[model samples]
Structures are given as C-alpha cells and as structure tokens.
Target: MKILVLLGALALAGCASKPVPPDWQADAKGALDGFTDDYLKGNTAAAEAEFRQARLATTATGRADHVAQVELVRCAAQAASLVFEDCPGYATLAADATATQRAYADYLAGRWQGLDPELLPEQHRPVLAGGPIGAVADPLARLVAAGAAFKAGRITPEGIAQAVETASNQGWRRPLLTWLGIQAQRADAAGDAAAATQIRRRIALAAGQR
Candidate 1:
C-alpha cells in the first residue's frame, strides 16, 4: 500500500508541471515570477546575495564556471524591474545573466547530461501562453545543437555570425533573434568579431533605422 501511495504521489507531481521547452513564454514567465516574487517582499538584496553564493558553487576553472555565471544574470534583471522604470544600469547585465544561468541549471537539475537527446519532447508549451514562435518542427533541436556545440567548443564566433546572418536573411523572429544575439555575444567574447558584427547588424536592422 505504501509503495502504491508513493507511486501515486510521484505521478501527481509529474502531472502538476511538465518540463517546459526552451523559449516557451510560460517557462520564461515562471522564471520571471520567481525573481519578481523575490524582488517583492523586500528580498531583492537577499536574492542578489543568493546569486553570489550560486556562483561560488561552480567548477574551479572551466566552462561550467562560465555556465554558472550565466545563472546570476537572472537576479540582476529581476532586481531592476521590480523597481518599475528604475532599471539597474547596463553593468548589471553580467550579473543578471549569471544569475539566470544558475537558476536554469538548478531547474534543469542535470537532466540533459548523458540523457538520450532523442527521448526529449520536440516542443512544449511554455508554462505561460504565447503563440508558436516558429514552425521549425523541432525548436528544442536548435537549443540542443547549440548547447552541444557550446560544450564541444564548436560554436566559434564566426560560426555564430554565420548563423545570425542566415537567420536574418531568412526572416526569423522572436526566440531566433534572441538566440542569435546571445550566441553572437558568446562567440564574440570568445574571439569571433565577425559573428558579433553580423549579429549586431541584424539586431539593428530589426530595430529599424540602424
């Protein structure tokens, strides 16, 4: 009876909220809410402090450390917006990214590691609602490819630039734009100026009057 009850509890927990797809509005909203809730209740300072601690939990010297830094980015963005228009300075973006990355890592709980990529669902609705961002038939595929390339050091600056250019010429939207910009920045920082320039130009074009 106890075994059956335990299984039932696990089943109920699974039914409550499934793993959300990347760039899903619902998932993003959940993250936003987590930060906003912390930002409210006079806990902004505490949230920021938590990010700092998460940073210390990284590998001593490796990409994983950089990955951890990415989580801290979330906290910084939340802290700024919680104050309405009084957004924090541009300098806070780094911290915001680090915090965000850390938060994602926590949410992911190491599930992607060694898991069969094919087993994961192709697409999922965000925890929040938004129209389908694209018709790629496999949005998760892009994220997984990008992540694999990142882990393998194959996503160089030039590669990112090329991808951004391609995406731009093809008239991609939403999450694609976001991904291009992010990948370009990472590649540029890793020494791919061409990729960064291409991404920036596309972004400027998207904004109009660039």
Candidate 2:
C-alpha cells in the first residue's frame, strides 16, 4: 500500500530529538507491511497477529501519534477492502494526532464538512472535488476513493465497476469478493437478474468455490 509516507512521518516524529531504536523502526515497518499484505489477501489470522506486532512496536515509542499512525494505516487498508468501521482506536488518539492525521481520519469517516482536500492524498483530492473516481490510476487509491464515495453516498456504478476491475487485476481476493458482492446486490436491487447471477458466479470464483 501507499503507507510508506505515513511510516516515514512516524519515524521522523520519533527521531525529532533522540534517535529512535533501529529495531523498533524495522519491526514496525515490517509488521505493518505484513499486516497490509495479509489483510488484503484475506489471511485474517496472520493479519491480526501482524497488526498487534505493529502496534506493539509503535507503542514502545511512548508517543500516541506513533500508535495513531499505525491505527490509521490499518483503517486505510480496511477501507480499501470496503470494510467500514468506527475506527475507535484512532478516536482514542485523536487528541494527540497531527492536523494532517485528523483530516485523513475525517476523510476516511466520510465527514467532508470543513475538510481540507489539500491535506488528503493526491489520488483522493480529486474525489472530494466531485471528479470521477475512475480517473485515479492507482489501484489501491481507486479502491480507497470508491470506499469513501460509498460512505458519502456518492458512489457511481462506474466507480464500482472500476473498483471491481482493479481488485480483480491485482488479485486482491478479499476486496474482489467484497466488491463483487456489492455489485451483485446492486444488480439484484435494480432487477437485473442476469447481471446479478454473473456477479455471484464471480464472487464464488473469488471465494474459491466451483
């Protein structure tokens, strides 16, 4: 995922005065990267374990912002998979979070009121301006935009199609299944039985069913 920037920021924050332990930085990055990969591939158990390890590494810094960055990274991955949660972990550290971090948290939560789009990721900036989400070239960025659009009740059929295509192309099984399921629901709701059936077949394939 595109979380290296946030990780770098966390590392910089930790090294503002004294140098952060190299082991802690390595452990946090490795665990966080593992968590993102495992979560995207649907390895829930491994993802959870890695997430815990990442959090532990960050917590060792004794800085709430470091932990908050970890939580934000987790939430961003979940968002890409179309999983919507309260992000209570981030809320707990909101007070200690940077303005940029708070803006991102609000962006992920669909609270666009008074939000500064400039603070958001470049791929997401256009989304806040009512631009087409399909225009975002990055696969993960496209999915993030789709999830945010869905939360904002502004997701278009084209956005959903692009997200499905992106997930399928990337072999992201977890999100492929979720987006396919959503497509099936939309087709069913619109009385397109044939389309819904086709989507369900794709869902079964993604889920490793015959």
How much is the lDDT of residue 105 in candidate 1?
30
Shift of residue 183 alpha carbon in model 2, Å:
0.7
Structural similarity to truth (TM-score) of each candidate: 0.29, 0.91
Pairs clashing in candidate 2?
Answer: none
Q: Where's the lowest-lDDT run of ten residues in candidate 2?
A: 5-14
Candidate 2 displacement at residue 44 in angstroms: 0.2
> 13-114, model 2: which lDDT tens digit per residue?
345588665687778888898898888889999999999999999899899988999999888778888898868889999999988889888888788878
Q: After superposition, how far is residue 37 of candidate 2 from its true place, in Å?
A: 0.6
Clashes per prediction? 24, 0
Best by lDDT: 2
Residue 81 of model 1 has an lDDT of 22
Give lDDT: candidate 1, residue 31. 38
Worst 10 residues of 1 by lDDT: 1-10
